[model samples]
Target: MFTDPIADYLTRIRNASRAGHRVVEVPASNLKKEITKILFDQGYILSYKFEDDQAQGSIKIALKYDKMTKEPVIRKIQRISKPGLRKYSGSEELPRVLNGLGIAIVSTSHGVMTSKQAKKEKVGGEVLCYVY
Candidate 1:
């Protein structure tokens, strides 16, 4: 039911999931739709596996309207580490570092993403496919 490149990406994710590989979820909002669109335009789709067949693996992402909320809630499917970077000493400093690099932390239907990526593509709402 997926179209071309999107289907391909979904298949890849599904296969990886079946093999027990971990995947990252990036969330986003309207401002980040550009990024999600980019992924779609490039034929990329996100998918995930579930414990039950009936369960929709798709996620629902919403825009952050409250300025009070600073960080997007991210679900860690795999251990994420910066290449060649040591563990951060302070939890408070993490956002400063990520933001310094122009990454926008967002909660998406698929997961979380940097503002840069979200602005580049169009991704939001409920997931239509499980990555794998």
Candidate 2:
């Protein structure tokens, strides 16, 4: 069993995008909310809203697409650090996605952030996922 909620979150979005769904919903958690925020901030997603229903809360995400091209903004998303094989990196060893064109979301001591932000903050932790 994977038991990786983060990976589940990413796969849900990926499946929805492939199905051309405008909105996708996932069971909510603080970590998922932070990741959604990062995706929104990086322009990979259009918007997101968190619905609180106690332990049954969820997140609604608006997937982004190019207006003129009708192509998804996020071309690829991959879970880099699995629960079985964790990947950790220091600030200097952070992965550069697509030669800086894409972003690697990292869970740092400071917080979950894009690799660029991590580099700027001079910290690093788990390399969570890659988005391009």
Candidate 3:
């Protein structure tokens, strides 16, 4: 059984990219879906879709690649919150990944959003992950 699905999700994508896989499948959950959406919106990933199954569903992600360099768009992905230690932050204390070059996914009261959006909306939440 997976103790941390978010970490698993990120690891799956990371491994797939390292192996030069175009796509990777992960066990689905609402949080995972939200994270996937955030990644797509930030242009780190190409696309994703959820498939229904008898048990929990599955998510298929189309990894992104550069046209000229043929390199993975996302160079790194890090999970902040975990089952043991839950990290939270306010809008003012929100992190700027790579001096704003990367994206930090935050789970706010308004819902899951990027640190930039959370800051704009003046909300604080648990720091989910940082992506570059």
Candidate 4:
């Protein structure tokens, strides 16, 4: 059993990307599904699919890479709010990742969304992670 599934999810993707894997699979949960959607919508990932099985489902994510450089599009992905120490920010205080070049995923009351979206929606909640 994993104590911090979100962290594990991030690590799996990070490792896969560093290893030049075309796709990475992660154990799924509602929060993870929402995060995956946010990543896809932001164009960080090439594509994603959710598979439901008898036990917990899993997510298959096609990571993005630069056409010419052959470098992974996602240079970094870091967890913010962790199980040990939680991180929260208001819409007004939301962080601007890489000066708006990157995205910060937040879990607001409205739903799990990018920090920019949360700012536009005028709500705040736990800050999940930073992805670029």
Candidate 5:
């Protein structure tokens, strides 16, 4: 049993990208699925698929890479809020990752969305993670 499934999800993608894996799989949940969608929408990942079975579903993510350099598109992905220490931020106080080059995923009352979207929507919630 994992204490933090979100952290585990981020770690799996990080490890797979570092290892140069084309496709990475993660055990999925509603939150994870939403996060995956956000990643796809932001172009951090190439593509993703959600597989539902009798038990907990799984997510298959195709990681993106630079064509010429053959480097992963996601330079860094770090979890912000944790099971132990929850980090919440208001729309006005949301972080600007990499001077707006990167994205901070937030779990807002509306739903999981990018910091920019949250700011535009005038909502606030837990700071999920940073991805660039």
Candidate 6:
């Protein structure tokens, strides 16, 4: 569940899809930047990282729900890890990769996940934004 303008914007997109309207893709270069601005203004994304040498990077984002916040205080943005990579078993193992990327993971009722986690969980929803 998202709030206000962003939520409304996504609704419009969804509605457009239902009505069979052609939707244009936002340019990739500005996609992360725009998301960062939105999340920063809304206090969702806390921080982020980017590197030329690193094919993989991560960002820390927060999940706000009815007065409860989880630990690590951040989350990572990386390629989805398959079940084979989960050495410890269970979603709990995800934090290790996130931590290695300088990300703090927050597990919520939504599930133990990250921006990358959503995909792994096969859960499709809006990506609130990126932190950096």
Every model's TM-score = 0.20, 0.96, 0.96, 0.98, 0.98, 0.23
Q: Rank the candidates by TM-score, best first.
A: 5, 4, 3, 2, 6, 1
lDDT of 5 at 50: 90
Better of 4 and 5 by lDDT: 5
List candidate 4 stretches off by more than 4 Å: none
Tens-digit lDDT string for candidate 4 (23-98):
9999999999999999999999999999997398899999999999999999999999999999999989999999
The digit string of per-residue lDDT tens for model 6 on 1-132 reads 333433333344334333433331221223334454444443543443332343433222233222353322223232222223421233433343423444222233464334355436744332332221
lDDT (CA) per prediction: 0.33, 0.93, 0.93, 0.95, 0.96, 0.35
Pairs with backbone N, CA or C atoms under 3 Å apart (clashes), candidate 3: none
Off by over 4 Å in 5: none
Summarize candidate 1's per-residue lDDT along 29-71 as a digit string, tens digits.
3333443443333233342222223343332222111236532
- Every candidate's CA RMSD: 16.1, 1.3, 0.9, 0.7, 0.7, 17.2
Off by over 4 Å in 1: 1-3, 23-132
lDDT of 3 by residue, 1-132 (tens): 888888898999999998889999999999889999999999998999899973988999999999999999989988898889999998899999999999999999899999999999999999999999
Query: So what's the TM-score on candidate 6?
Result: 0.23
Cα misplacement distance, residue 102 of candidate 2 (Å): 0.6
Candidate 5 residues 1-132, lDDT tens each? Answer: 999999999999999999999999999899999999999999999999999873988999999999999999999999999989999999899999999999999999899999999999999999999999
- Which ten-residue region of model 4 has the weakest summed lDDT? 49-58
Instruction: Write the residue-wise lDDT of candidate 2 on 25-110 in tens digits.
Output: 99898889999999999999999999997676999999999899888899999999998999999999999999999999999989
User: Which candidate leads in lDDT?
Assistant: 5
